[model samples]
Target chain A: QQPVQSPQAVILREGEDAVINCSSSKALYSVHWYRQKHGEAPVFLMILLKGGEQKGHDKISASFNEKKQQSSLYLTASQLSYSGTYFCGSRKTGANSKLTFGKGITLSVRP
Target chain B: EAGVVQSPRYKIIEKKQPVAFWCNPISGHNTLYWYLQNLGQGPELLIRYENEEAVDDSQLPKDRFSAERLKGVDSTLKIQPAELGDSAVYLCASSATGELFFGEGSRLTVL
Candidate 1:
């Protein structure tokens, strides 16, 4: 099943902060975050494994709540280069590497 | 390392026509996947291959769509008698373990 994302879209200015949330009805073994620019392929940003782990990439980071079956991506001090659609993929038990992505959240970072 | 590679960044076809997209996964990657993304939506997996064997294809529309990864390195997805609904971006991804890397994707426009 596809994961659900909140705040379908958001606009931010440089040095601002934004968060994208993803929730799944089923349990998740891992959660991954990706960003896609217009007309470009989605790029892997970070992956949060089970056990309520967290990972970071420069100013972007994510946290996974395994018990809640949810994840959230945090973009701090957003930059114009961060303008893109963010997608979260979840891997459920018994399904290794079979990711179901959430409807992307478009983030527009202005100058 | 070179990421997944896809050709014909864009294609235009009419209904009932045939179209094919190609992808070359990252060197030494053992898993490859194909996904379809409609405008303003997340990607949906179409097929996945381990080595040269397809491990999951339950989501692929075999009636009109076919995919193959002959050498376990490069792959191809073909759509015969393409329908208007096939107008979307076809994404190819590869993974070494858990995190997946995507290509630039091939966008199809059907008239």
Candidate 2:
């Protein structure tokens, strides 16, 4: 099953902050985040494993809550380059585990 | 190192025609995935290959869609008698662990 993402779209001014949330009905072993610019491939952002680790890079951060079966991506001091579609892929534990992705959220950062 | 490579970047064909897309994964990667993404939507997994074995392909339209990862290095996805609804971007990704490296994608337009 595909994960569900909140806030289908968001618009932000440069330096603003935004959060995209992903939730799954099943227990997740890991949550992976990626961002895709127009006409470009999706680039890996970060991965949060089951231990509830919060990872960040520069102004981008993410948190995964195993108990809640959810993950959130945080973008602080958003830049123009941040404008793109964000997708969250979740992998469930157990045999035959496969990664499933959410429908995605579009983030637009303006100057 | 070169990321996942896919070609051609764009293709157009009439309905009922056959179309094929190719992908070469990152060196030493053991997993390859094919996904379909509609405009304004996130990628949906069509198939996943662990080495040369297809571990998951339940989401693929078996009647008209087929895929193969030959020698566990390169992959090809083909659609026979393509329909208008098949017009979408085909993305190929490879992974050594779980974080994926994606190609630019092959955009298919069925007219």
Candidate 3:
């Protein structure tokens, strides 16, 4: 089943912060985050494993709560380049694991 | 290294016509996936291949949609007697472990 994302859209000024959350009904072994610019392919952001580790890149970070089957992406001091659609893909524990994605959240960072 | 490669970035066809899209995954990647993305939405998985084996294709519209990843490196997705609702972006991604690398998708417009 597909994951559910909160806040379908968000607009923020430069240097602002935003959070996107993804929740799955089933237990998740891993969560993957991606960002897609308009008319472009989705770019890999980061992956959080079941260990519940928090990962970061630049001003972006994410936390995974395996017990709750939820993940949250954090963008701090957002940049204009941060404008895009964000997606979270979840993988369940088992053989032949496949990534199921959420509908997505649009994030617009303005100058 | 080159990321996933997809051909014919844009295609237009009348309803009832057949359309096909192709993808070549990243070198040495054992997993390939096909996804469909509607405008303003996140990608939905159509099929997933582990090596040459299609481990998960439960989401694919089997009646009119078919896919193959022969030799485990290249893949093709086909839609026969396409309908207007089939217009969407087809995205191809590959992964060695689990973090996917995507290609610029093939956009299909069925009129």
User: Please, what is the whole-model Cα lDDT of each candidate in the order they appear?
Assistant: 0.92, 0.93, 0.93
lDDT by residue for model 3 (B27-105), tens: 9999999999999888999999999999889999999999998888899999998999999999999988779999999
Give lDDT tens digits, candidate 2, residues A19-100.
Answer: 9999999989899999999999999999899989999999999999989999999999999999999999999973236878
Lowest-scoring 10 consecutive residues by lDDT in candidate 2 chain B?
A: B93-102
| Candidate 3 CAPRI-style tier | medium
Winning model by DockQ: 1
Q: Which residue pairs in candidate 1 collide?
A: none
Per-candidate TM-score against the hidden true structure: 0.97, 0.97, 0.96
Candidate 1 residues B65-95, lDDT tens each? 9999998999999999999999999999998
Worst window of 10 by summed lDDT in candidate 3 chain A: A92-101
Could you give candidate 1's per-residue lDDT for residues A1-111 as a string of tens digits? 999999999998899999989999998888889999998889999888889988888999899998899899999999999999999999986435588899999999988
Candidates ranked by DockQ: 1, 3, 2
Off by over 4 Å in 1: none
Q: For candidate 2, what is the total of clashing residue pairs? A: 0
> DockQ scores for all the models shown?
0.76, 0.68, 0.73
lDDT of 1 at A39: 86
